[model samples]
Target: MSLEVTVVQACLRSGRGGSRTAVVEDGDLSDAARRTVPGAVGASQAVFIAAQDPAAVRLRFFTSTGELPACGHGTVAALAVLAQRSGNDRYDGVLHSTTRSLPGHAIGNAGHYSAAFEPGPIDLRAATIEEADPILSALRVSAEVAGCHVASVGRPRLLVELADRQTLANLAPDMPTLQAVTDRLDLLGCYVYVTPSSDGHTVARMFAPSIGVPEDIANANSTACAAAHLSTRGHSKLQVDMGDSLGQPATMTATVTGSPGTPIVEVGGTATISGRHHLD
Candidate 1:
């Protein structure tokens, strides 16, 4: 059997660079089959739309390594494709996945789409020196770190804050060592970022070799983790800039509401349907 896959680039910067994700609208595919789509299409992740209705849409996410409980960019890409196919400029519904269900909305305009959704629960905590030392060694960085914490927006990511953008840009992690550290810590990936600029924009990058992603062009869930970490420090809204190292520059917006220790985070970004693929 052959499956048609729609390629979408989410979290684009000026309609140019973003993460390329494959979206497949098939309900009958097994977990094993879904895992093959990403590798076959040269994409890091694939989203399967198992079912849809006027009120809700069910989605499943996968990487070449295995299935994921949730995915931020994949969710945005899937919602954009669904809105376009429905011939509507706007779509409002719930996104159901194996791990959680989130209220989501998408807007399509002039061949571009913006999608946002509430992620799962938020958890943030400071990291001990023992936890931080191994990761820092793997990253091969001795620069002064401003803050170190473990954060989660359904998925756990080690959020490391550097003193300046220069330090953040100079990162060259040992992928093998970093992967081992993530596995030991039971983390999804490591998110290294600089402090927010005066205008409330942050620059960052993500690495998750344990999940077969050596470097992510744009990581929405990690962005949410950053938002949650900063919200505790009195930041309510901010934009995250990522993907520059690999040349696929991307931007994602994160809004934090409610209060500290229990903040609500919403992640969103624009995406375009770049092309398609046929998976056998």
Candidate 2:
């Protein structure tokens, strides 16, 4: 069987360099990720699309290892392709994944688009100080942590706050140990961030080896979780700088509304269309 695929780099900084994603229109193919992802497109994640209704489209994300409950950058890439196919600068649709339903809206034309989505009902919990020891050990860093917490938007991520941006940028995680800790805690990955700057920009990094992503260029799912966690501490709008540790530099924009307990968050940024291909 053959299928058409479009690859886009989402959450780019200065309209260049971001996470590479492959978007495939929904068809009869099963186990699509194992078939095309990382091989045909050389993507970190793959999105399978199916029309749910007249107003929305169902999205499924997969890595080289397995399917994910939801994916932020993948969603943006999928929506960008969908809107371009429909020839509409502004499009509205629902992103239906196995465990979530998100409302997605996108703007701009082909090869360049901006996407935003509302990830509903996130669970935030504080990770005990004892839990921090394992993460610090896994990263091979000193015990100079500021705080630690866990956030679950669509996937679970352990959020670790370091002493400062310098410390955050100087991380070198032991992949084997990180994978072990992720397995023990049943987490999707760990999101490490610094304290918010005066301009409300937070520099962060994401490391997820258990799910087959060693380090994400720009993570939208966990960043929203981070934003929700920040909302509790009296910050609403946040601009996150990620991927610097990898030299692929990406940016993420997040805004949280309403109260801390009941908050609505949107993670969005511009994306560039890299290329497209087909699989057989």
Candidate 3:
């Protein structure tokens, strides 16, 4: 069998600092393209690629494992790339990502271009008691896993609210269990969130070490929607402090205004394009 993939290596230096993504797709791509594409960079490296058939720009996440729904940093990178690729149109409105969220789809907003992604609802029910212990062990979180919930930001992730910031910061989870939880619950991974009085709203840090991420994530757009829902319900805005504690800290902001269903979930930050590479 002959296999081919077209990959685009996109760079984004924004809220989360910087990430190099190599997007790959088969069917009309050169051999060189597949060699340097995102996931091909390393084992399990996360790459954001667009699956276009009818010329429809639908974004898909190509992790070391398979395709994922939504990816915040990748989407941001993609938005900027899409704007440049479209050549004519500017994605000013909320353009949808390929992934599905609980509410509908994940939405990304760029001044020149934006994306909308339909993610599953913010569901705490999908998380099971059987999976908690294994997940906590995977993250190396030794704290008491009391408040555990599941949310479908863009891709489904297990949200575990720790006792406090101190506990949240110090974690060294077991990888097998981490992978096990997602395999069992069939979630994206786990995002450890907490409420630090200094911030007022709940502060969360996400990690999918099992799926390929090793440290704190800079900005999670998908998580922003879930936080928005939680914020609206809790009457508090979600102040997501991601990628910090691990040192390179970044923040994502989402407000709780407008109607419940079609409510607008906006995440704000600066995205800088350090560089771009052509695949073969």
Candidate 4:
């Protein structure tokens, strides 16, 4: 048996550069096969597109660690590939993860594709200065920053505010302690950010020790959660600059609609096909 896969880098030059390789498979990919394929291709995540439909196609994502409940970048990459391969200028698809089903849409041609999706619930809970002090201390960040809060979409991520973009960029997180905090709180990881200029662009860095991704290049879902948090505080739409710590930085923009309590968050970004491979 043989499987064909297309590799894609999502969020392009913005945020932390990341890729999702979509495996063109006919039937369900076994758990072991799912783990083996991505690892063999040297990709952090993989999306398997099966049973295609013009209205919506079935898609699933996996990582070296295990099957993910949902993946924002993975969805974008899958939809982009679908559009490119099918020669459709636009497409609507359903990305079925292990735990949730998300609707995805994409527009573009060939190597350039823009994709968007409605993420799951986003809730922002205020975290007091005292509550976040310990974590900041662990990360060598100060507690004086104003916008510290915890944001939860499908997963919980600590959104910490810093004094400036430079500080956020210079971060060197203590992975051991950071991992402990994420595990204790059952969080996916922490997203540290700051608004340096008057342009209102929020620069950020995502760290997830729980999943062994010390620093995620570009994290779409978490960035959407940040957008929702900012919307609750009066900012509706903004560019989220992430993954600057890594040389291959990427940028993404997110928008939030409706009231703060029930905001609809959408994350949009471009994806480029990086490579293609086959496995048997």
Which candidate gets the maximum TM-score versus the true structure? 1
Residue range 29-65, candidate 2, lDDT tens digits: 6684444565567788888888746565788788888
Error of 4 at 239 (Å): 0.8
Between prediction 3 and prediction 4, which has the larger TM-score?
4
Which prediction has more favorable TM-score, 1 or 4?
1
Q: What is the C-alpha lDDT of each candidate?
A: 0.88, 0.83, 0.51, 0.74
Compare candidates 1 and 4 on lDDT and give the better one.
1
Q: Can you tell me which runs of candidate 2 are displaced by over 4 Å? A: 32-35
Order of quality (TM-score): 1, 2, 4, 3
Worst window of 10 by summed lDDT in candidate 3? 4-13
TM-score to true structure, per model: 0.96, 0.95, 0.69, 0.88
Q: Which run of 10 residues does model 1 get worst, by summed lDDT?
A: 50-59
How does model 1 score by TM-score?
Answer: 0.96
Taking all chains together, the TM-score of candidate 2 against the true structure is 0.95
lDDT of 3 by residue, 56-168 (tens): 45555555544555666565555555555545444432444564421212223332333323233444343566766677767887667656666666556677767687787
The parts of candidate 4 lying over 4 Å away from their true place are 14-26, 53-56, 128-134, 196-198
Candidate 1 vs candidate 3: the TM-score winner is 1
What is the alpha-carbon lDDT of model 2 when measured against the actual structure?
A: 0.83
Q: Backbone clash tally for model 1? A: 0
